[model samples]
Target: MNDYKATVAVIGLGGIGGVAAASLCHGGCHEVVACGRRPLDRLRLERPEGEVEVPIRTLTDPQDASPVDWVLLVTKAQDTASAAPWLERLCGPATRVAVMQNGIDHAARVKPFIGEAIVVPTIVYYNGERIAPDHVRIRHIGDNDMLAPDTEDGRAFAALFENVPISVGLSADFTTLAWRKLMINVVVNPITALTRLRQGVLQHTDIRNLTRQILDEAVAVARADGADLKDDEAERMAQFIGGFPEDAGSSMYFDTLAGRPLESRALTGALVEIGSRHGIPTPVNTSLLALTNAVSDANG
Candidate 1:
């Protein structure tokens, strides 16, 4: 297993980070370094297939870290600032950094600390949760897919996950890709968080109509922002979400329940911000953004 040569630092070992660390370790092709605020000797990932234990060099302090071949910034968008110290130490001139968080314009978000490193924007499609320290529960049985821009660095980033179960591929149009994922997040996250319900709420006729309006608003904003989204994208997403598992919940819902700060700013807030900049109205998303922020403030 030690034969795999590349060194990877997975920052913020939460659900997404845990899944990435586990899959990469399962690939058996790279040395993984788990970075977080707490110390952990190992990471336990519980998938439907079976349980996987990945032993990693966990570091609590940025001082103990050094430059790696790849740095996976898996923190929430709102916490980008907090991960600055880790990025400062883990990135070098040639290091390829992947921003594995939600929202668009990922490269610009981390550009401040990454300096000359190649920044790859990654969009992850999977469901997982960190149930305890060093332990995570894979919420879905489907394959975890990661989509990156079709470029030299993007392909190289995808190569790091070779032999892993997750699907790592490149997209010719990353703008549409990011907007597509954002459409899903904006639709389901706020509703689930506000109603304290899971994705099952979308099954209701009234809720489905509301979801459509939200998606429509977000799609409009995305189009104005230069994404090539289709007219029927909202309709298609509403149908898909309606058929989702009754107990399926979004990260926002989980964060609200856990009393953790919400990433509303990254999800809906981003939509609203860009919509304003482009002179496009995002009334539905703006309202959701306010409600989600209120929930976060309450929790705080």
Candidate 2:
């Protein structure tokens, strides 16, 4: 039933990219290419209902890849450079690159690699865990698994998932929504990674107060960046953070435990950068950024 309607190349087959590739293949609406550091013959997708095993075509070498209609750049912000080879091969003038990672500067991170291609900044709310290199688990975290700007390409990106279980939404004010998402990341990633704990740490009263401080400063930065956030945005975000599952571990926590460089530079670190640009004082995030950097440097 697959007519190869479109060519979709997914680079960085971690939790997010892996599950996305499997979903697209299961949907059978496009010709999906799973590009990674090594060749893989099959992918196991664990869902709430059951597990699915999909036979997939994976390209471990960049030279074998060609321009595709869509490139889902799912690499961590810090590893964007490592994925340059794959982006160069899979991106063309007609390509639309959907960056499905943390941080706000999605286009700036991936633009240089994709020549004349459109950069689609995306917000992913789904929780995905890479249990193994070939095995991945996905849990939808919100009403929508993904969100894109309400543009023609964003609509098309959403349509690509209409036939699949994962839901994609289009937003007119994607920037504001993106900042909202970043507001969450700035709290969870740093707290979890620094404490070497999971989301449970955020439940502590002291930690909750700390979360407020971080958000107050970060929210100021977000509003300065024109995100339409209110003065009480920090309070709103704290309530939202309280809703996360305690057992859930953040991406940075996992990276810290694995002795890999944390994505702090993108999450908390990005907040600091934006805050500085706006001449706003992000003392809380700035300190966290330094701690996270030390942790990341020790890992590297």
Candidate 3:
């Protein structure tokens, strides 16, 4: 086991952040600090087995946040700017910031605040929902791992999750993994949001075909970006989504239905932009991005 004791601060106590903070605290390796828009005492977490009242220090303002060895950002990509102040306050010389949100542009997003500190890009896979102001329902305890490129700080961050159920591994080709996840997101998220349906609803023949098209476009974009993704990867992703519970709703779908701001730019929009840069046509993704943006604007 690695012998490193570092303070951890998790910004944005949403589904992913709250669970990560609790897991880190439960591991007894690091001092986990939970920070959010509201005060920490006001937060609560609802798990499948029972409700957990987090005891860590909670701060509503970034200025009130204490410096730590690592900062995990779990907020929506669009909310990165709002969390900047907290990031600045929580980061020290040796601190490392991990972006646990969606999308492939993790490093680029936080480069402004953390110039020297390691900005680790991580892809989180867990099915969780915020049931209340301080309560989150963890639907699935799927692999809670993070893949980082080979680096000293990346190795250190991986060691932190070693004892815990969360797996952290080093990936020489991190971009491919990220793009693969993005393709999976592209296939399932928009359709679920548009239809107000769950994962299993896409099992219909027509819906499945549409999902395949989206995945194909995303795969093309990934290839153009120098990420080697197989043609059948899209079908495999669709099959994975088909295996989920019939009533399971993705975070993107939930956000769309609730009239909250969606991660349009981070999800489908990013694919379209990258595809254009490589002169690769991504009509399906481009169309979906446009539609989602329109829906978000209409809802707003």
Candidate 4:
């Protein structure tokens, strides 16, 4: 018999967290313990495939946690500090912690709390929303893949989702892959939040042109930072954003609507900072970052 069974702890029971926890349970090869702001009895994952409810062992206190084989940090990029206490309790020497968040600096964000080598940077492309405290609705439009760096830990992390509906794979050029994804985030998230519209807002020609400008700057920065991106990557990302449902909203937009702190620093602000380091002017992203920060500060 195959003898490998992973013990997993999923911190951050938001939309992405719920999906990750449900997928782990659906795989049936792991024992999952969930940690969130509050405890949940079970998780309801409504996927395009079907709906599956999985009972979860939930904990709200870090002291109640134990070390596990894997730790899936699924919080927004800005909430990494709030999630660190749980990481301290749940991460053992041999434990691999996968940061499933936005932007390109996943390892940089969590490496101080966990060791550098043990932090597996990951990117998840599926759209999901938490409709209830214990329920999440996953929207499957085109791709629902999780990309990780090509490493031993990355392979082991991908292996955890073998039979699950989610696709997990390694990126040979992870830096480029991560930057490419960040370029999309730079264009789509802040604009949607600022406009108070869904993904379909990009369908407007003016907004689409603005998005292309933002993405072009990000692509230039990524290339300077050693990411192998195409010259027309901006247009391609704009086309991809057009593919989302009309009512589909990003996590940043949802957070803004819910009056929570927006993740502008992690998304647009990071772009500006990196662009400056490379001596590239990112005017569009810089303006978006300032506007997003102003709105978030006023609301939050």
lDDT of 4 by residue, 98-176 (tens): 9989988777788877653388888887776888998998765445478888888898888888877788878789999
List TM-scores for all candidates, in order. 0.94, 0.97, 0.90, 0.94
Model 3: residues with Cα > 4 Å off, grouped in runs: 42-52, 139-144
Identify the leading candidate in terms of lDDT.
2
Looking at model 4, residue 63 earns an lDDT score of 96
TM-score winner among the candidates? Answer: 2
lDDT of 1 by residue, 190-216 (tens): 999999899888788899889988988
User: How displaced is residue 232 in candidate 2, in Å?
Assistant: 1.8
Regions more than 4 Å wrong, model 2: 1-4
Measured on C-alpha atoms, candidate 1 has an lDDT of 0.86
In each prediction, how many residue pairs overlap at the backbone (N, C-alpha, C within less than 3 A)? 0, 0, 1, 0
By how many angstroms RMSD does model 1 differ from the true structure? 2.1
lDDT tens per residue, model 3, 1-300? 867888888888788887777667667788777887776553465655566665667777776776788999899988898888888888877789989888988888888876577788887866656766567655444554567766776787788787665667787788898898898787778888878788877888898888888887888889888887887877787787667677777877898888987788888988988889999898888888888888877776
Give the per-residue lDDT digits (tens) of candidate 2, residues 198-277. 99999999999999999998888888988988777889889989988899888889999999998888888888998999
Sort by TM-score, best first: what order? 2, 4, 1, 3
What are the Cα lDDT values of the candidates?
0.86, 0.90, 0.78, 0.85
